[model samples]
Target: MRADRLVSLVLLLRRQGRMSAAALARELEVSTRTVLRDIEALSAAGVPVYAERGRYGGFALLPGFQTELTGLNHDEALALLIAGSRRGAQAFGLGSALASAMLKVVDALPESHRDTAAGAAQRLLIDPDTDLLSRRTAAEDVPDAIVAEVRRAVFAGHKLRIHYAAVDQPPKWRTVDPIGLVTVRDQGYLLATRSGDDRTYRLSRILAAEELDEPAQRPDRVDLGQAWQERSTRFRTGGDQVAVLVRLHPSRRDELVATALTVLAEDADADGRLRMELTFQDSRHAEWALWQLSTSAEALAPQWLRTTLHNRAAAIATRYEDSP
Candidate 1:
């Protein structure tokens, strides 16, 4: 920890030119005495650290001192390059530059490590597949430029004029003040405020986005994290509400009861099967539960659910019967 602090102190001085002991101590979570000692240790190791006295007093590194990156071995260097290349491409748009830098780093490695690195690289492929975009329909081919602009506006707290495609409705232009972006599985979403109401728009549905010249402001009481959490909870709970009783093997009973659908009651049968009463939000959810229980459990409640299950089974059997 002390060594880490000393290294951080040196880097801080290099970046900021000078820093007082109190400032360094606060950043490093140490005392002024500890910072002073670290400065002395750095100076002893020929770091050229100097301290000035008085109100403007602080530690500074001598001019022309260079920091070297000699600690990383070949494998470590290759790993860092790969990680950096992936991040740079995804986050910072430094695609080809990152790849070129990685090539140079890999070429500089020794023959043995280079061979190992090549094998590792081949085995650990990080392909950002472009094929998924091909599956999108004409309606979904919203420009990447528009998406990027919306993302920037959201981060910058700027208002946006967007041409959006609403479900079962014609495309219309709307002005929204973007709060943040939400990523749901493969799709990106914008959570925004429009006319005092919160709205979520799919990225693919956005036809165009124009950033307004006015600076953006957030509502004092609005919390994006809390809003997303509540939205998720409501979505999960809004499905069909039905009580279901199922008998599961004793071994799997505990796991079954621990699912999101609450277990209202439980009983152990003489034959070692555990009967559980559970509630499901919808028929689809109930069907999913029954599918999971196939061969291992039995539904014991709501005759309609059992009938639906039987009908589904008959349809599935008909499909197989019609198969070659």
Candidate 2:
């Protein structure tokens, strides 16, 4: 931890140009004496650090000097800076750690490359919370305390007790063995298990979490990727899947197919509409997808779906008919 603190201390001066001993102590959460000692250690290690006396004067790096982080070229450094710009770390409650690491990265670069790297990173944006369409993503409201506890339990190989609200279920308390944390499409999930059964809890849905004293009852060395894949496969196969046949306009064919779980068959119908056999998660899923296309697509098979659409159209028509 002291080594990390020293590195951070150096990086802080590099980033801020200079800081008073008190400022350094506050930033690193240590006493001013510790900061002065770390400054001595940095100087002894051949860092180009120096001090200036009097008001508005403090410790700073020598002009144009850098403590080159081992083996990273400018481009590789640029890539990492870009990766850090993504606020995804905030979801896992690692924001402060990510910030400190990024400071060290910039400071570690060769002086000739540091400014260029920071400037270049500024030009490249990653996941700006909103898009060109002006649709902003809802921020996940995770309590800092809950995320900290959950993250610790995952890494420490411990069980966790959580107040959870499962999909379509009321909130309830449960015990789980946390395997890992995952963020997808800006949403976070805690990959866990309950009594040896695979369970995935959306981090956003975690109402409260308590790291348990008992050790985890799960595998010590879990390959999270493989476990997630297995769970995903089972979930997909066990869900309600349906095959849909539809007549779609030529221009909308691609869009419809893109939304379906699979496009089983495709052909031109007698009237030139593109006929597509598609797979959806279920009937409700099929209805939602096709309804979005409106007149550009018409569901043909599964008479029940056809009747549902017909009834919807009839109801709309009746509304207007009754108005007059």
Q: For each candidate, what TM-score against the reference?
A: 0.47, 0.68
Q: Write the per-residue lDDT of candidate 2 for residues 160-272, one digit (tens) a residue.
A: 99999876799999999999987666677899989888899899889999998899988768887888888767755567888888989999977887778777899997889
Once fitted onto the true fold, the runs of candidate 2 whose alpha carbons sit more than 4 angstroms away are 1-87, 282-284, 301-324
Q: Indicate the worst ten consecutive residues by lDDT in candidate 2.
A: 70-79
Give the best candidate by lDDT. 2
Please name the candidate that would achieve the greatest TM-score relative to the true structure.
2
Model 1, span 2-76: residue lDDT tens: 554565667567655789999988766679999988888988888999988888989898986766522433333
Per-model C-alpha lDDT, please? 0.69, 0.81
Model 1 poorest ten-residue lDDT run: 88-97
Q: What's the CA RMSD of model 1 in angstroms?
A: 17.7
Q: Per the 3 Å backbone cut-off, how many clashing residue pairs does candidate 1 have?
A: 4
The superposed Cα distance between candidate 2 and the true structure at residue 120, in angstroms, equals: 1.9
